[model samples]
Target: MSEGNHSSVTEFILTGFPGLHPEYYGLTSAVLFFVYFLTVVGNATVLFLFATNRSLHKPMYYIILNLSVCDILFSTTTLPKIISKYWFHSGAISFTACFIQMYFVHCLGTVNSFILFLMALDRYMAICHPLRYPNVLTNSTILILSISAWTIASALCSRLVIVAYPLPYCASNIINHCYCDHIGITMLACTDRAPYGFPAFLTAMVTLLGPLAFIIFSYICIIVAVSKTAHSQGCLKSLSTCSTQLIIISLYYLPRCFVYLASNVGITFNADVRIVVIMLYSLAPPMINPLIYCLRAKDMRESFLKQFRRITIPKKGQVSALKKS
Candidate 1:
């Protein structure tokens, strides 16, 4: 077996957007940096809320926490290099490091899909089988399932790296995308890309469509259950509770599915447009998810308020001592 060291290319240049004018590099970098910042702060806040608030220790919140972590990790994996590339004219990435980035990028994305599936399953149980939910999905069970998702995703993503690393690269080392993904890097190989490309595509389909199918079915069941409610208000409330998640799910999945299908099905799209769409689905979810949670979840809002007050408001004794001082 030829090792990665045998490959001619030692590094790769990440072409963030093929059509982006050089003059816009600064602006592009600023936008991406802001996105990265928001993603980190927003998702980190969710983690903080989950960590500090005991009231959030439930099956539903477990999924929220897992999703937040996945979002943060995915953003971290894909955003910084692009930001650096545009900001400092530093697009070079070591071959090994590129593969490492690709691994995390795909792994975390898969984990997010599975976590969303869990969220859908939790809602399904709550709405469709309310009586059995208490016995079915406990905190411990969710934890195990979460760990299994991460483990399986990690294992699956490693295959892409394994298959792509050893291919011979004659000369071309430029990757015409924002990151070193399976498609971007493997396409540069001198040999036939079929062996690596097909399996990777198959894996991507399985990882994305598999969970997405369940999520759709679960929501369908949820809608049916909500529709059967006797009062209109009850139906509205049930649908309202799901609206936030549905928005997030659509943001993450729809664009991705479109891009993948468009590329595979001979539907032509501009390369720059494709990259922008990829960035949106990859980064937007992480940045906006916390806002959705804050708006939709009363308990989380209250907890955030409580935490803010605990930090901002002083004790009476301390206030009096400060006045004396």
Candidate 2:
């Protein structure tokens, strides 16, 4: 059979997990539901906090909101369907649906990496060039930059949707993962090389390595600049910003390298290992980003807590009054 003429696999069997007995479905379903629910609620609260708190009307929080949005999209790309399939025992998705999932997963993932890079750059500018910082990263400029990030990400990932869609799908449709992943779906391709291999590598590098290098380099410059400053408070403040960003960047970037970049080298292809790595790379960032910034950053914590108290104290008093009456 010629490479092109080889009847293309219509779908893939997702090896989501080792087969669970029917009895455990209830327990697994409950657990997945709770996890997805909490993820949604946590990300939604961060977005809401970023929006309503006027004190948070700064570049840092704006970047955070962007991160939260990306995280929500990131989680949605796979987790929801994965949860459904395992829980229901009928987690079948069409060829079209899988391609769409693969596209957005990469697109949002690329945007997330870019957003983090921008966040690092913003910190660097704020510390290294204080007076000019406001002028340089103005609201208009951030808006333009954020738009540019998304546009570039979309353009980069557009190839996946274009290439994956045209291939003929046949009887083999079981996707090993709960949702459509590039690595998982690409394994099933008849052409074997073009539909999945080259584009995936190119996009992974653009999405993962490029942004990580920028973030690390930006921080290096910021650290040097901060050391030169004579002002104690300025130095401390700069360190604080860099520290928060460093923590998040380290956590997010490493897993991405392990999952996407390392996978390219054709390491041991264990499905379970792949899922765990993907979860860390995908789910952990959004989950911890708000925690890092809100809990660790003093001003953000104070602002978030103060706002929470302001909104909640009145309701508490009203509840007490109602109980007394």
Candidate 3:
């Protein structure tokens, strides 16, 4: 594994969940397929409702739409290959495809963090600065913010990929994770990986923690403002909104923080246990987000019910014709 004898890796064999028992591969693949199905259906329902309903064309719904799209992209990027690996025993991935997956995985993740932060900001504006909320979060403003999130996330992730790609991956080509990622792939490099690893780690922390800090601050201000309101109903309503956002935020960040701490502080966890934790944090949010965020909204719930009825209910003429027949 000397630097002088370094050779480029062409493909990688993904050892997804090495601790998973071979006897349970079928069961695990089925469960993953079910989760992936739910993720797609839930997020797609949210996106379709937003796209087709003129009533949901507001700034808040627009942000939710963006979030739904991100969930779909994230789930698509990570889940299918793992499912294929478990079900069909197909785990070989080309070097180019691995890096491509790594790029989108981190890129979408960064985008999601910023989107959640933006959501908190939107709520803060609506509650604390109601008079200026409309002007502050106009369509144009939201568009610019969303674009900035994608652009900045892509740029930072691109740098990480660029730094990691050219390094000599002369050692083992087996990635011990479900998919390609900065840490999982970079660690396979033959030479001193400190130069690449440190920057990638730093970037990951900033991407995850920076938005998290802003989200926390935003919620604090929101809670303070809501507490100062005279009406108890308004306070309850505001608290309810903030609570949902906080739950989603906690689900997304807490497990990630735990993993980082455990890995860095020498806290040992079984390989399967660690992978399960990662999957839960990464996949659970996307699967349940539509329920937490969209279904929780009174208007959205009502609209969805109404839409469902429209699709299921028969026309008056058709009902009469059926009765006559």
Better of 2 and 3 by TM-score: 3
Candidate with best TM-score? 1
Across residues 1-325, which tens digit of lDDT does each residue of candidate 3 receive? 2434334567899888998789999998999999999999999999888777888888888788889999999999999999999999999999889999999999999999999989988998998899999999998888899999999999999998888877887879998889898878887887787777767777878878998998888888988999899999999999988888898899998898787667645698787788878888899999999998667887677778888888767676688889999
User: Per-residue alpha-carbon lDDT of model 2 for 133-153, expressed as tens digits?
Assistant: 988888778888889999998
Candidate 3 accuracy as lDDT: 0.87
Q: Whole-model Cα lDDT per candidate?
A: 0.88, 0.75, 0.87
Ten contiguous residues with the weakest lDDT in model 2: 1-10
Candidate order by TM-score, highest to lowest? 1, 3, 2
Question: Which lDDT tens digits does candidate 1 get at residues 1-325?
Answer: 4655445777899989999999999999999999999989988998999899999888998899998889888888989999999999999999889999999988998999899889889989988999999999999999999999999999999887887777787678999899888888887888887767777888888888998999999999999889888999989988998988999889888998887777666798788888988988888889999888876888888889998888767776688899999
| lDDT (Cα, 0-100) at 117 in candidate 2 | 86
Position 115, candidate 1: lDDT: 91
The C-alpha stretches of model 3 lying farther than 4 A from their native spots are 1-8, 261-268, 315-320
Report the lDDT of model 1 for residue 116.
Answer: 87
